[model samples]
Target: MSVTVCLGSQFGDEGKGKLVDILANNANLCCRAQGGNNAGHTIVANGKTFDFHILPSGLINPKCINLVGSGCVVHVPSFFKELEALEKHGLNTTERIFISDRAHVVFDLHQLVDGLEEAELANSFIGTTRKGIGPTYSTKMTRSGVRIADIFDPEIFESKLRRLAHGFQRRFGELLKYDLEAEISRYKNYREKLVPYVIDQIPMLNSAKEQKMDILVEGANAIMLDIDYGTYPFVTSSNTGLGGVLTGLNLGWRSIKEVIGVVKAYTTRVGSGPFPSEQLNEIGDKLQGVGQEVGVTTGRKRRCGWLDLVIIKYSHDVNDYTSLNLTKLDVLDDFEEIKVATGYSFQGQKLESFPANPETLAKVDVTYETLPGWKIPTTGAKYFYDLPVNARKYVEFIEKAVGVKIRWIGVGPGRENMISR
Candidate 1:
């Protein structure tokens, strides 16, 4: 009968799906706060792996309800594609899923523009997923965007699309060509197909709160990729933390009871950003190979590095996580030693905390604390005491540094491969 907000403490792909999948069992409703199809969650259930982009993985829980809130930007075609894909897998989503009508929709033009924008900055590309998330958010802020509700009314949808097309054509008329007439016809069908899932979720969520049902808010990207808090320009367009959950779901702060921050045993980042602790050598290769560090959205190889306590400490300060979930601990089994970044040094002077500026952050040198590796597999450990001594010590070090209890540990990819304390 409580609400829990689960988010990533690092630069996303922190194994949040597994944590949400675990928590969804007890929850009645699970809502996605911010982000779009650019973020991906891979979940393993019933010996099958499901990759979720625009949908909540909580759908794996038979009795849990799912909501795509107003803070998200929905691509109608992609949304249906996901639903169709799930339905093909025998997952019936008719009554279990709901989408906020206030959610902005992403058009094909947005995706084209996203690619064009990235192409223009080839030298310093943001490494976007090309999912049109940034452009969709831009239109949403500019008040020229189309909402899910507008799609139900053809007149309103056409007017908005025309106005939006005018701006796009004026800016990149020579660079891109789009047939608005065809798009309109196609979307009319999409609207009909999506009508059932669309609803005003704010009141529904509030009503659920009044009924004292457990609500779980699953955050998309990690705290470091938050538009305002993360490394700017390289970050995602929406807030990906506690503040986002409030704005996304239209929920009061008092509705939340706990915030769980999920972090990997080692650090990995997908795309371009200032990674202070990136290991570019044998250790990095080892972690990458063992952990299978690949981006779920883009299929790009993730940059691997040692565990950085500096980043987690900063994440802890921002989100104030009630507890933590440590993932991929089994990936470190073969290592003889493990390194954790405890501090950063800039200009030969010790830095006090994580620097805000990307340039300054890029230049800072990481100071590491070496710990003995367990050199033993910890997959499917059922309890905290089941971890090897060194593995337990590693989790303990993080707990003391971040001042949050390690409530769960992800030893493998499967839903059952975890330890609860």
Candidate 2:
């Protein structure tokens, strides 16, 4: 069988974990390609909610093998903490989960540097999760970052830790608060705990492909946070789009069989960026309340807005998605009418595509197409036709506008709370 990749069509927290958890049951292996613990996935299964950061959402599937690929940055403490919590939840992950030996390590010193850097920037900060994701990726690119394998050799690990400490001191000095000896001792213990999970993931995944084993690549963050393609200076450090799957997992493009993109019925973004369709009125407030628009990773209140087709179309074009999964449709049940942005007009000029410049995007006027709302409960609907007529029209309109099929429609937060069309 070929690999299937599930990506977020909008910004992060598109309820990808819920969909991945549902899909993971059919796969033999599930791999987290990129991003760090800064991104989170929340899954509701059997009435229990599982929030994952640094761990693959597939961990909920008992028979599936989960691997954290080399494209990720593993924060040792956070990783272990999450692992312990999973064990407490009665999930057996010891034999199924593995971490790439080449994955860069995120230490406490990195978090310190992250906070210090954000403080220095003050107003222009990218609103990071303060999980040291950006700093860890920065160190990886600089080739001075430590890896899971580095901790195996005591001498090498100690020397590397000392060098990293010195580097931080030289760069941030007084702003960084860390004890060298304490950190070194703490890491030595972490190395012991993480030793069992560390392995060469590239060969493992490649061999799986050769054996015809089914695999699923889970992505963190989303298309709009990709460093190269997204809003500059306000995006994540790594590529959060399609190309990232190849670089993150060391897999060939031909191995991919399907790319499924998940999008919420309405748009919600965390952190700082330009959102042309942001609804700052009662409509935005209602959506936020009903949808529970809050970041899973940071717990920050998400900025809610009407759906923007321009952004969704841009995401489709960039990712080349085969199908889309529209989520949180129940959130719009109470409205009499719903507005969806069809295009963007910047400075009185209609733009053909998403603006690349942040300034241009901030000044753009969204051209919206309003449709009658269903104004009825759809939380238990099991089929597309079962939904209210107007609700189906909204879905069809989005499908036609983006020129992609909607394979799944989420009505609630449970595994069974979806309509498969």
Top lDDT hit: 1
Clashes found in each candidate (C-alpha, N, C closer than 3 A): 0, 0
Q: What would you estimate as the lDDT of candidate 2?
A: 0.91
Would you list the clashing residue pairs of candidate 2?
Answer: none
- lDDT comparing candidate 1 with the true structure: 0.91
Ten-residue region with minimum lDDT total, candidate 1: 374-383
What are the lDDT figures for the candidates, one per model?
0.91, 0.91
Local accuracy of candidate 1 as per-residue lDDT tens digits, 1-421: 5889999999999999988998999999999989899989998888888889999988989899999999999998999899889888888887999899999999998998899889988889999999999999999999999999999999999999999988999988789778878889999788788878999997898799889999999999899999988988789999998989989997689878999999999999988989988999999999889899999999999999998999998998999899999999999999999999999999999999788899999999888999999878898588889889999999999999888999899999998898889
Model 1 off-target regions past 4 Å?
none
Q: Could you give me the TM-score of model 2 versus the true structure?
A: 0.98
> lDDT per residue, candidate 2, 1-421, as tens digits?
6899999988888889988998999999999989989988999998788889999999999999999998999898888889888888888897899999988989898888899999888888888899999988998998888988999998998888789889989998777789989988998787778778999987898789888988999999999999988887789888999988889897789889999999999999999988889999999899889999888889999999999889899999999999999999999999999999999887788899888999899998889999999989999899999899999999999999999999999999999998888
